[model samples]
Target: MNCRRLNIINRNSQRLLFLVNQLLDFKKVEQNGFTVQFSRQNVTNLVTAVAERFAPSIEQMGGKLVVEQCERDIEADVDAEALTKLVSNLLNNARKYMKDRIVIACHADEGQGWFTISVSDNGVGISRDNQEKIFKPFFQVMDDNRESKGGTGLGLSIVQSVVEAHKGEIKVESSLGNGATFIVTLPLRQEGVTASAGNDIMSPAEDKGCSRAIDGGVNDVSRPVMLIVDDNEEMLQFITSNFNSDYEVVTAVNGKEALDKLSRHEVALIVSDWMMPVMNGVELCRAVRSNCNYSHIPFILLTAKTDNYSKIEGLNCGADAYVEKPFSVNYLEARIHNLVEMRKLLREKFSQTPLEPINTIAPNPVDDQFLTQLTNIIEENFSNPELSVDFLANRMGISRSGLYAKIKTLANVTPNELIQLTRLKKAAKLLAENKYRINEICYMVGFNSSSYFSKCFQRQFGIKPGEFTPHSL
Candidate 1:
């Protein structure tokens, strides 16, 4: 068959398979007394079933399926039907694209109550540019090739959605020609929620209601109060839109205006462009620091210039962090979260010990050591986009559980939380200085998406970054 015809067939097959699985899940849900039952299943068994189901096709394509068993049982609490579909889609993709042997490895740690199910193949792996897009719906890395291979470009996206529904995380490790490994980690069971009661199967509307309720309360507590300092009206509106959620955003076009707003209302954070007509980010930071009342408020400098000297100059002028232009929203959100957490801690400590200096050392040396090591590790990998808890644990030669425990004991935050905080602090400095475009600043701080970044940034700052201009106060 021609590539196009084959692709059409593949798409049809995938859709058919998805429909069948959905029906099966629905049936299973009905049979299981309408309770969401999270059960522990073996990864090896799951992969074997999926591979066997696709054996005929694999054999026709002249490929072999290889299963690798780790020393432990790879177990997770998942809806059996959904989990099965996730595995099947991954394996199906591997078999269709690969010319040789496909390997499925199961790694589990009973102590940690987690597992990583990885399906890999000697096929043409995903390119770096296409990696992120792959999880997005209807985004196929190779449209022409995939057409011939018969893919609807929805397999990975479905996999992602299903995994997220199960409250798990999925990641891809791939490079062109090297092979691709899709790893999924899920909890053995939902913590605090009993499996005996079954999974709480809620309708879409009910789920939305629950989410709204949760978000409503969170919005009240975590709403960001942003102070924007920019001279451009268009830029101010653009920045404000990026952070309206989770923020009571305010705006000013210049330093004086920002300072005036600051005086009138309490702002959690400041996002300022570096080059402004009347008073810039550097000038603003200087002004804020000079004022005894506002010196403690976090400041971020956003600039288009990605020079070492410029960054240093901004930092020296009391900017907490710096971000270059053309940044990702994900990076900016992470940075903002970090700064906000720091400010919260500082405020709490300041309130508790009014007479004491804020710089008092941590009481525990063990915690101090761990924090130092963590800080060093974070600094070393500050530029890495995938620098997360998993990455940190792998780098530190510790298990995820161990890393979490150590971080919680030493830093008073989870490893993931710490990473987010670190990134947020860095982004805050750039925003306060206002040197770069908001989008540019987001990615420069290592966030993958600007919308997500703004949400996070607003959560930390109590206002949108666009409204926290030095001139406003």
Candidate 2:
């Protein structure tokens, strides 16, 4: 084909694909709900309809599209449009790039409460290097060469996003010269899930669960106010965006302003920076803790300080948590959720408690000594991921086994767990105050994955990180 003819063909093809993709995308979004109507017949008809639509395209590309037969009809609680888009994207990719044959398969196991639909293509396979990048937005490996097909590069990204939105996962397996296979797994619809009508697909119960998870059950009217302290405009904007959805977020530029805000407002949580002028986080924490009125309110310190001494000092100075810098949005959100939940729960507990007579509480001398020593160790090597039992023991001139035993005896937990717990708790506070995202919070707290950070948060608090933020209140 001439250059002009090829260009014309490419444009026409892209336009057609774009229209089809948009229609499918719209359908998925529109039909997604807690209860969707799909019987075995419906699934079959839908699959057949999609296959027929793509068959001509596949034939034009000299590729055969084969649909593998399953033993029984598969009915799933899924948006048909979403599923169709996923399947169609996979098929289109295979047909466009694959060398010869494409296989589309669906499997249903009612006993397992899960169904899987997969598309396998025998084409010029994707390299390992490009597999992960393929799902990212506007990323195309085959750019403008003759062999390079036409696409806007949004297909796979959209597919992944839609799947994740539906609470599902997409997995890809490919090797250079070996074709790629894409698998999508979804929850099978049984009688348990309520089927609801309207474009708002999630059931009332699911919505409640999501709301409860993202926002702690603080009544909107009674939710404690929060004051955010940050100097960077971008950081402040990001923080505000994350919290404005649920909380009445107020921002301050520095510790001095933070104190000023606290004086004027009944702030439930104070999130301040460690490096701010006029007063740093330690100074702010000390100031707040010293005052009887603000002492009860939880204080969270955000800083780039990874040193153990810094964290310990912040915690010791009445800061509820100390989140480190360079955190993820999700991790930060999770942490915020955690602190909010804790604050709400504590408020409830305190409200229910009978007033106690004034009494002097003695400080534990042993705890002070231990905390001092721990601070020294953490300060010495906060950057070391393996700064755990072996490292601490080595530093203290003791054996690994002995150090582990001693730490357990003193702290009632493993040394590593304690360290991680401390890091996560601090991270959670930063998150609740909308200081960072989950991923940033993960790194800030010395974690590698937002998912891992979330798991750790759940383990520590018996709730997901998202549930810590007060949504209603």
- Report the Cα lDDT for residue 374, model 2: 61
lDDT of 2 by residue, 1-473 (tens): 46567446644754675656555554564466222344233455456557766765577678788888888777666666456666667777777778878888888777877778888887767888888799876677672253567666667877786576556778888886778899987767544343532223233433321121212222233434778887654456556654553456889888788888877776766777787667777887787766533554557788879998877887888776778765544566777779656545543332222121001110123333444566467544556767777777767665665545434323334556546545654665676687777778777766777787787666555567666663411
Worst 10 residues of 1 by lDDT: 209-218
lDDT of each: 0.65, 0.62
Clash totals for all candidate models: 88, 32
Candidate 1's TM-score: 0.35
Q: What's the CA error at residue 126 for candidate 2, in Å?
A: 23
Off by over 4 Å in 1: 1-36, 143-148, 192-473
Q: Write the per-residue lDDT of candidate 1 for residues 1-473, one digit (tens) a residue.
A: 56567446644654575555545554554465223446654555656556655655566689888878677555566666567668877897787668587888777667877777788888887789988898875566663345546556667766776677777789988888887888988777664333531233444433221121111111122454789777755456545644654467899878888899977766767888888767888899888877634554667778878888998898888887787754544477778878766655653442222122223322233334545566678866777878888988877776776666444422335566556655565666676687888788778767778887776665554456576553432
